[model samples]
Target: MDMEYLKQFSLDGKVALVTGAAYGIGFAIAKAYAKAGAKIAFNCRGEKHMEEALAAYKAEGIEAKGYYCDVTKEDEVQKMVADIEKELGTIDILVNNAGIIKRIPMLEMSAEDFRQVVDIDLNAPFIVSKAVIPGMLKKGHGKIINICSMMSELGRETVSAYAAAKGGLKMLTRNICSEYGNANIQCNGIGPGYIATPQTAPLRTPGHPFNEFILAKTPANRWGTTEDLEGPAIFLASDASNFVNGHILYVDGGILAYIGKQP
Candidate 1:
């Protein structure tokens, strides 16, 4: 047991920026990162959720702040990154967790729906990542965790576009690591399973067959919680994952390995 080799899990004095931090997995990750001793810049849709997250962090006795960053907007995203670096100091890590998905069937899904999902989920990561890279490069070290999805590797009938976007995100992450690994920057992704969140609550409703199928497929025999991802998030954000670059770490509940369909 080498003592000095074990300090990579600590994130003291680092700064992190997490998008979609108002609630759900993003919020949980932000709070956990703060608890691990990182100054946080949590972003949401509006000022209210940002303030609420900030206040909660204050209660936890950790340094946290709020910012308005619409990941879809290039200019706004750029300004937010700059503002975060200037106000909160350099952003040592970034979590691209802001995304949305529409559940309509492909034939019935509108063009706008597909575009919106791709824009926010996939395109925004590209925009925001670009905005933050220069800062990371200048500082000579940074970590990026793009919130991917199980859909990145698996496909569903009604969610073709969502799957496509996430798949693209997977390659994008690898490409980023390939191009920037030499610069001391690490880029990876977190593909969460069926987490119980406000956004995912609809997936687990009364008379919903999806829920039953999901549980049966997962070896854990239950849905995951947002809290389940906090440990992995902290590890990725900290120095623990310094050698872990261009990887898609699946936090799924073994559903990915299940070969049998639900009976």
Candidate 2:
């Protein structure tokens, strides 16, 4: 293998902003970017999470900068971006990893609740992207990776709002690519399927119906881990994916392609 070919995957000197990176999926991606030598900046909406996040990064020997900003609010997002630019230079990679999910049934869910989910999941990406695109354009190249969900393509019970928001996010990713590709901006998405996070540990216990169901539906017969998403996230945020845009790379265990196994 040519050593020069591997350089395309390096993010050295690039500045990356990963929203909602206090923990879980966002944290994993940010850690991966730091490993690839990018300067890391992330946000948390609350003081407690912000403090904890800074500690977590430090534990990893990463000197990550954390900001307290609500992504759904444009003004707060704008300020965060400006601060990041001042501290870390213009952002060359943006991972729109901040989002929320409301698993309420359609009829039972209130419009306000639905709107809140959409605002964070869909609109925050738009707001944050708008804030960073100008900097990216000035830099003459950039990468924006939206953390979409499997719901972007498939729907399940009790997730009406999440599905809608993620579906809209999918289109938003494509639209960003369409609008900014000419300016050397590559906007893409990562759609994770049934990631096994601490929040889902209860559901993943042995003999759990939901766990069994997920395993049956997934061709890999296992849940995805945050580690599983790291490489793909790195690729999308690196020069390796300069030509890859407007695409949702599902880091699923083939759940989207398989029907359930026979009983």
Candidate 3:
């Protein structure tokens, strides 16, 4: 392969906006973009989260621009985008990573709770993507990555709202690509598998049933890590994926492909 071919992966001179990137998967992707030479901008709903995220980013030697915004609100999203444009530049890359999940069963899930999940997981991406697309259009190029979940394809118990929202997000990802491909804007998704984050720490204890189940089901026999997602996020954000639009890249440790150990 040509050495120049590998250079296509570099994100130099790009400005990336990763929403709700206070921590977890969003933080990891932002770090990856920074490592690849992209300026990082992230938003959080509260000042507490924003401060924490800023400290974390600073500790890592990444000078990330942090904002306060509730991504689910269209007005807040629009304002945040405008601020980012004024402070940074026209957003060249957008990572719609803000989301919420209500793990109540379908029957027990309240309509209000369901709507909240949909608003954050599905609608917020639509809102934020809409806000940034105009700038992207004027700039003549952009990349939008929706943070989807495996629930986009598979259903599970006690997560009806999450599944519904993710399923909608998957379709929205495709729809954005369909609408904007001609404009040189690529919209795609990253459906992460069960990752070992602090939020999942309780479930990942050694000998925990859920941990064992995940290990047995995955062909890779291990839960995914934030670092595991960094490369894929970078690829989707970089020039290398200019032609790869409307795709959902699952970083699932092969769980989606494997049918589970033979009972």
Query: Which candidate number maximizes TM-score?
Result: 2
Query: What are the per-residue Cα lDDT tens digits for candidate 2 across 1-263?
Result: 99899999999999999999999999999999999999999998788898999999999999999988989999999999999999889999999998888878899999999999999999999999999999999989999999998999988898998899999999999999999999999999999989999999999998999999999999999999999999999999998998999999999999999988999
Query: Which of the predicted structures, 1 or 3, would earn the higher TM-score when compared with the native?
Result: 3
| Deviating ranges (above 4 Å) for candidate 3 | 1-3
The order by descending TM-score is: 2, 3, 1
Error of 3 at 202 (Å): 2.0
TM-score of 1: 0.92
Q: 56 in model 2: Cα distance from truth in Å?
A: 0.4
Indicate the residue-level lDDT of 30 in model 3: 96
> Could you tell which candidate, 1 or 3, scores higher by lDDT?
3
Off by over 4 Å in 1: 1-5, 59-62, 198-208
Worst 10 residues of 2 by lDDT: 97-106
lDDT of 3 by residue, 24-103 (tens): 99999999999999999999877888889999999999999998888888998899899999998899999999888877
